[model samples]
Target: MTVQEQYPARYYARYDHAATQPAPVTGWYDVWGMSDASSVPDAADLVALSAAQWSARTPTGLGVQNGQIVSYAPPAPTLAAQARSALVQAQAATWAKFGSLGKTVTDDWITYQQALSAIADGSNATATDLPSAPSS
Candidate 1:
C-alpha cells in the first residue's frame, strides 16, 4: 500500500467556516469533505513517507501533496537519531546540574555539553555513545 494509504492525513476541520485552532476539530476531510474532496487540506504527515520514498531521512521525514511538501512526525528513529536525542537530554541535564554555578561550571562539563552538540544524527551513533556525565 502507498504511504498515504498506510498513514492517512488525519482530518481536523474547523467547527464552522470561521474559526481558529482547538475550538475543537469537526471533521477529517480525508474521510469527510466539503463540496469537493480534492480542494481543502489543513496539513500533512510526512515523516514515514520520506523514508519510504528514499532510503535516507531525518527525524522529520518529507512528504508532498498536490505538489507541495509537508514536514511533521515520522516513524521511529534510527540508532543515530536515538543517540542524538539522548545527547540532547544529557545536555539538558548538564545544564540543570550546573546552571546555578554560573561561571563556575567546570571546563570538562562545558566540553562535554559541546561534544553532545557536535554529534550529528546522520551517522551510526548509538545511545551508548552519549558523553559520560561529570562526577560533580
Candidate 2:
C-alpha cells in the first residue's frame, strides 16, 4: 500500500513520556522501525494520535511542554492562499461531476472547468472573482 504523505491541518503525534529516550516529533510522525522513519528526540514509539479511549479526538494541534498542553502559532494563511485553495476545490468537484457527462455537458460547465483549471495553473494563481459553479 502507498503511504499517506499529506497531513491534516491539526496533526498530532504521541510518544512514550518516560521511555524510548527521545521521539517527540511535531507534524507527521517521521520515526519508525529504523527503515520508514528517522529517529526522533525526546520521545519513543512515535504514533499519530486521532482519538481518546472515549469520544472522538479533535484536531487541535495540541502540544506538550514540560507536561502541559500548549498552543502553537502556525502562520495564518493569506487571502490569496485561501482563494487559490477554493479554486482547487471547485476544480475537483466540477471535474468529478461534469467530466464524465460527455455529450450531456453544457457549454457553461465546460467554460467553468476551463477557467478553474486556468486559475489553478498560470503564475496568477489567486482570484477574488471566480466563476460561479453550475447548479447542482
Candidate 3:
C-alpha cells in the first residue's frame, strides 16, 4: 500500500478541520477549513513523511518539497547499518552506565586535543625561545 494510503492524509486533515467552522461558499458549494492552521505544519509529521518518501524514491536519499531541498539520513545496508546501530547503542549504554565517568573522560580528551593542537601550531613556544629555533 502507498504511504499516503497506509496513513491517510485525509484522516489528519479531517481531524484538523473538525474543530473549525465551515467555510462560506456560494450557497451550493461548501468548503471545509482547518480549525487550527498552525497545527497543520507539525515538524515531526513532516519529517516522517519526508523520510518515507525519500527512502522509497530519492536516489540521494534527500528531497525537495515546497521549494527547498533537504538533506536526509541515508537508508543503510543490513550489515553496515546493523554495525553502526550496535555502535550507537553501545556508546549510549556506556554513557548511561558511567555518566560522570564518561563526562570526565570526554573532558580530559578535549583538554588533551587542545594541548596537542597548541603544540603542533607552536603556540606553546615563548618569544624568548624563538631565536633558538631558526625562523622558517
Question: Residue 54 of model 1: what lDDT?
Answer: 36
Error of 1 at 105 (Å): 1.7
TM-score, prediction 1 = 0.34
lDDT of each: 0.46, 0.49, 0.35
Q: Worst lDDT window (10 residues) for model 1?
A: 19-28
Q: List candidate 1 segments past 4 Å from native.
A: 1-76, 121-128
C-alpha-based local distance difference test score of model 3: 0.35
For every model shown, the clashing-pair count is 1, 6, 0
Per-model TM-score, in order, reads 0.34, 0.37, 0.20
lDDT tens per residue, model 2, 1-136 = 2123322212246534663323232444433223443333333333444435113332554444444334534456654555468667766676677675653556777776677556656545555466677776
Candidates in descending TM-score order: 2, 1, 3
Better of 1 and 3 by TM-score: 1
Residue-level lDDT tens digits of model 1 in 1-136: 4424444643322233332221222333332323344444433422222323333333343333333334433455655565567677766776777675564667887776566556554432443466676777
| Candidate 3 per-residue lDDT over residues 1-136, each given as its tens digit | 3333334332221112222223111111001123344434433233233344333443433433332334445343444333344445544554654564644435443344344344435565432221111111
